[model samples]
Each structure stands twice: as C-alpha cells, then as structure tokens.
Target: MSRVTLAQWQMLAAVVEHGGFSRAAEAVHKSPSTLNHAVHKLEEQLGVAVLEPVGRQVRLTEAGELLLRRARQLLENADALEDVASRLAEGLEAEIVLAIDQIFPPDALARSLDAFSEAFPHVRVQLHETVLHGGVEMLEDGQVDLLVSGLSARGFLGEPLVTVRFIAVAHPEHALHRLDRELDLRDLEQHRQLVVRDSAQRQSLDSGWLKAEQRWTVSHLDTSIGMLERNLGFAWVPETRIRPALEAGRLKPLPLTAGGVREIPLQIIHRDQDRAGPATRAMAEQLRTSVAACAGTRNFENIE
Candidate 1:
C-alpha cells in the first residue's frame, strides 16, 4: 500500500494552483527543496509520475489530475469535520445554506433573512432562489441545509409554510382583454403563452394550465411577468409580484372560463429534522413567522 500523507497531497495541489514549486513553497510557508522532496517521494510511493516539466513551468500528468481531484474532496471533508467539531463544541455554525422556491413571496423571504442576519450576526448565510422543482432537488442533493418549496420530495415530511396565489394576467391592451368575454382554452391556445421552465436537471415538471400552441419558455417568473407587461405573451404570475402592475393598469387578470387562478401550498423542508442544528431550526422558525405575518394569520399553529 502507498504511504501517501495529506501533507504531500496538499503540497501537490498548491504546486498545481500556484503554478510552480517555488511559488507554492512561498505560499505554503515551506522551503522549495522540501516541496520538491515531498512530490518526488509521493511519486515514488505511488509508482507514477504526477508532474511533468513544460519549459519554465510544470503541469500535472493524467494520473496526477485524477489523484488531485480525489485529494480535493478529501481535504474538503477533513475541513468539514473540523468545522462540525467546532460547531458542536460551541453553539453556532460557520455557515448555513438555504434554498427557497421562486413562487414564495419575496417580501416574506426578505423579512425572514433580515431577522436571521440580526439574530446570527456571526454565522454566514448563503441563499439560493430556485424555480419549480429546483429547491427540492437542491435539498435532495444535500447541497443546501434548508429548503422552502411548493412540492415535497417523497419519503420526506415538510412543514406547511404558506399558500401562494397565482393569477392569469396579460397587458391591458392585449387581444384577450379586447375580447371582453370569458375565454376558453381554445382562445388561449391561439395566443402566445409565457411559460416558466422547470429548473430540475433530472425530472422537469410542467405546472399550471398550458395549452397554447405558441409558447415562450423562460427561466424565471420575473421574466414571464416582464414579457407579459411588454405584450409579448400572457402568463399565470404570482399575485404578490404583479400587484403594482395590476393597480397601475400595466397588467390585468385574464377572464378565463376556467383555471384563472391557482393556489400553491409551500412548505419548509429539512433533510433530517432530528439532526437539525440550532441555526437551522432558528431559521425555520423565522420563516414560519414571516409567512404568518404575510398571511395576516395570528394563529400560526393552524398552518397545514
């Protein structure tokens, strides 16, 4: 078995990152000869040439590239172990990554984050705003510490947060508004519909009623709203997002014969509720409070 040490892998990575041995030695506070010796010993132990000379510079061989990739993961896991140890000894975590659905009211999210920042000033926060199926995917992939989503993943329980209302809307002067009658699916199919594409990489989901022959798929709800305002197409947009537009006559609700409005129930999800840390639990509480405030419901216990 090869007796390779973490120090040797770190040295190799530093050399690759900083360009040369001398530079890496300076960066890592080691002598050039020590770094050179470590690399040579590592290659001898592994029985493979890791680095090759390229004129004045050095480059990793194919074997070196593969080993370095694995080394990076090991180093990251080692760092995480230390971080978790420190957090367990203390009461605060180093950082918390949160993923939230796009349809969730932005004002509620902002308020919750603002409160969390004040409460945990020492802890760093990373926020990801995702579209349909995106937040669930992030949670399942273990990329985020917490998730707020409209759809729940199978085998995991989610706490109900709030319900968001969506309404079919278009520019005031659009042909649909000019019709001045309750329109059916056939009428909408003849016009252009603005659709937001699902952000899931493995399984894409189509939401709401979509039967338009001419459709424009966008990556975000804001883009769909913008397109609707410009008379590019009609879309089902969050009521909270288009309130100003509706009052200003920039956009108006479509008089659909059916399926004019949709209410989506959003929930807070954690990978393991039993293992949730203090910061994560606190953030979840803040999210629930913010949603309750937005809904004007004093009885938050009634949620779900």
Candidate 2:
C-alpha cells in the first residue's frame, strides 16, 4: 500500500488553490514551512513532481492535475464520511420511514427525496405511497416517522404544506365530456366514476367519491389515471398529477358549472417531533422546502 496520506493531498491542493505554500499556510492556519514540507514529502513519496514554480506563483504539473482531479473525489468522500460519523454521534436515524399520500405533487416529492439523499447519503429511506387514510393509519400506529397527507391524525398535529387542487376530468371520448356544456352532479352519477381505494385496512375513507351508480375502485392513483385516460371512467384528479395529460388534451375537464374543481389542503405530520432524529427532521425540512420551491413552477399553492 502507498504511504501517501490525505493530509498530503490536502496540502498539495491548498498550495495549488492559494497560488503558493505561504498563502495556503495562512489560509489553513499552518506555518509556511510546514505546508511546504508536506507538499514536498507528498511529491517525494509519489515520485512525481506535483507543482511547478512560475515567477512568484506555483501551478500544478500535468501529472499533478490528473492526480489532483481524482484526489478531490477522495477528499469529498472523506469529508462525507466524517459528516456521517458526526450525525450518528448526534443520534441520526439509521432509517427513516415516510408515508406520503398519492395525491401529493409528484415533482415536489421527487425533488424532496433527491435533496434528502444528498444530505443523508448513508441513511436508509422507506417511502410508502399511500392514499386517503393510509398514511394517517401509519402515523397513528407509529409505523412511519413522517406523514404527508390531506387528512389529519387524532393526536398528532400537522403543519400545512400545500393545497392540491383536483379537476374533474375524463378521456376526450368519454360520455361526460360529450355533454359539451356545464355538467352537474346528476349527469356524473349516470357515468362510471373511477375512484382510488383507501389503503387503510382498519379505517378507510371514500374521499372524492360522487356516489355514481356505476363506480370502479382501484388500488392506486396511477391505475385510476390509466383508466381515466382510456375513457373507462371519469374522476377528479389532482391538477399537478395530470397537468401533462390535460395540457396534451389526453384528458378533458368535465366543465361542471360548480364543483368542477376541488381542493385538498395537505400537511406534513411528524410522529414525534421532539424525539425525531436529525435525518428524519432533515427529510421533513427538505419536503417543505421542495414544495415551496415548486410553487413557482407548478399550479399548487402553499397552505398559508
């Protein structure tokens, strides 16, 4: 194994970054002679000249440029390792369990998860895509560390996150849109209404159901959207989830004179905020920030 140390690479990088050993030493709180010796020793150990003096400044040699480029990755990994260790010392959760309702904005959810992965790379994540009371059940049973839902738990309070608007829509060829005028609840009851099944085993909800004579229940939102796109039924879907379909004319709004659009205010709930670990709290923060950042891009609004 090579005897070169991370400190040696760091000193070499500092010398290159600060133009010379003297400035690098001042920046790193080290003596100029010490920084100079570290770089010299690193070059000697590697048997490669890592720096070339030019007038009063120093620059990396060609070989040094290539080596340092790879070394930077190593330095970053080492820094991340230390950060993980520090978080673990502060009681970071080994794994975070998150339950989010399916109606939540897909783009915002993805952005939150992407940011969470960057901040806690080593922490495992368990994401449960739920519907209606499904996430509430997990929060009530202590199965999830965090919950993002439109419904509220009995005891646990939730901070308002975003308001998701639902639009009554169906395929362009569906009977509902063929009416070609402002529809009403009476007209919808005659058609098949697609409904996403509530995932809670014990206490489920029939949210957004219009009590149509012909009702089809599916397990997931995607399934309902698939059926809606195929002219199988009409249902109210979140605007964010079906924006592309609406924009592309794959789906047409029911054009109801009233209740054509509905809104659900979702909130971020913590299992135990006081005892939540750093990773869990960070995940929650990312979710909030992600939704806030998406407000400008998407049609959703923050629940003030």
lDDT tens digits, residue span 184-240, model 2: 889989999999999999998888788899999999999999999889999998988
Candidate 1 lDDT score relative to the true structure: 0.85
The C-alpha RMSD in Å for every predicted model, in order, reads 11.8, 3.6
List residue ranges in candidate 1 displaced over 4 A.
1-88, 297-304
For residues 1-304, write the lDDT of model 1, one tens digit per residue. Answer: 4399888999999999988999999999999899999999999999999999998779999999999999999888877777767766876667889988888888788889899988776578999888778878888898888888899887678988887888899999999999999998889999998888888888888776467788888898888889998999899887888888987999999998788888889889997878878898889999999887867532222233
lDDT of 1 at 27: 100
Clashes of 2: 0
Model 1: which ten-residue window has the lowest total lDDT? 295-304
Clashes of 1: 0
